[model samples]
Target chain A: QQPVQSPQAVILREGEDAVINCSSSKALYSVHWYRQKHGEAPVFLMILLKGGEQKGHDKISASFNEKKQQSSLYLTASQLSYSGTYFCPRRRNLEGSTLGRLYFGRGTQLTVWP
Target chain B: EPEVTQTPSHQVTQMGQEVILRCVPISNHLYFYWYRQILGQKVEFLVSFYNNEISEKSEIFDDQFSVERPDGSNFTLKIRSTKLEDSAMYFCASSRQGYTEAFFGQGTRLTVV
Candidate 1:
């Protein structure tokens, strides 16, 4: 099943901070994050494994909680270029499925102003 | 950096016509996938390919949809008798391994009338 993302949309100003959360009903092995601008392809951000490791780049960071089957993306000091929709594709345990199949969440739309 | 490349960028077709979207995944990658997103909706998985065969597919990938890796470098998704609902942005992605980061292509905007 597809994961669920919270705060369908968010608005932020330059230098502000925000958190986007994703939760899945099924147990997840890993979570992949991506950001998509208007009319563009989804850009890879980071991946969080089930070990509870936190991954980040620049001002964006993400953490995964295996027990809760949830992951969260933190955008620090947001910039105008950060304006986009964030998606979390949760990878479930591949007991009876393909390894590369990722179920994407509905996405969290973030709009950052100058 | 090596990235996935897609052709045409945009395509317009009539209902019941066949449409084929093409992609060139990064060299050395072992996994290829197809996804689509309708305007203002979430991205949906269509299928996954590996080792020149389909590894998994979603329900959205019905009988009307088929995928092929005609050559070592090219992968294609063919839709037979497309319907208006088939209009969406199709994205191709590839990854070095089954459980690694996958890079997405620019995507092909398909419009069916």
Candidate 2:
């Protein structure tokens, strides 16, 4: 099943902050975040595999709450390069096996303006 | 850094014609996948290939669609008879293992008119 992402679209000035949320109906084994620029392929951002795991790189960070079946991505002091669609892809445990197939959310379109 | 490479960044074909999109995944990756994204829509997984066989596929990957790894470095997705709806950006990705992060190709934009 596809996960649901909130704030379908957001516009921000450079150096601002934004939060994108993803929620799933099923238990997720991991949540992977990606950023896709216009006319380009999605780029890997970060992956959260454990509950309460908070991973940060530069000004971007994410949190996964397995108990809530939700994950949130945080972008602080956003840069113009951050303008793109943010996607959260997740996998579920299937009969003790990870399907390895990632179902992606609809995506949050973030536009950072100068 | 190694990256997945796709050919013919853009292709325009008449409806009902055959089309094949190619990809060369990272040399050491063990898992390969194909995904598609219609303009302004979410990316959807089409199929996952491993060990020269399909591990899993979505309903979108019907009989008309087939995948092949004919050589050590080439992976291909062939569409027998294309339809206008098949027009989309197709991306190829590969990962070293099932649960790791996958790297995606720049994507082949297929335009079936």
| Two-chain DockQ for each candidate model | 0.60, 0.57
Q: Is the docking of candidate 1 incorrect, acceptable, medium or high quality?
A: medium
lDDT of all predictions: 0.90, 0.91
Model 2 pairs whose backbones collide? none
Per-residue lDDT tens digits of candidate 1, residues B40-109?
8888999999988998999999999999999889999999999999999999999888888889999999
Candidate 1, superposed: residue stretches over 4 Å from native:
A93-97
Per-residue CA lDDT of model 2 for A1-114, tens digit only, reads 878999999999999999999999988778889999998999999989888999999999999998998999999999999999999987653433434677877789999999
* Tens-place lDDT digits, model 2, residues B1-113: 99999997999999999999999999999889999999988889999998889999999999999999999999999999999999999999998888888899999999999
User: What TM-score does chain A of model 2 get?
Assistant: 0.93
Lowest lDDT block of 10, candidate 1 chain B: B94-103
Q: What share of the true interface contacts does each candidate keep?
A: 0.61, 0.54
Evaluate model 2: give its TM-score: 0.95
Give every collision pair in model 1. Answer: none
In candidate 2, position A16 carries an lDDT of 99
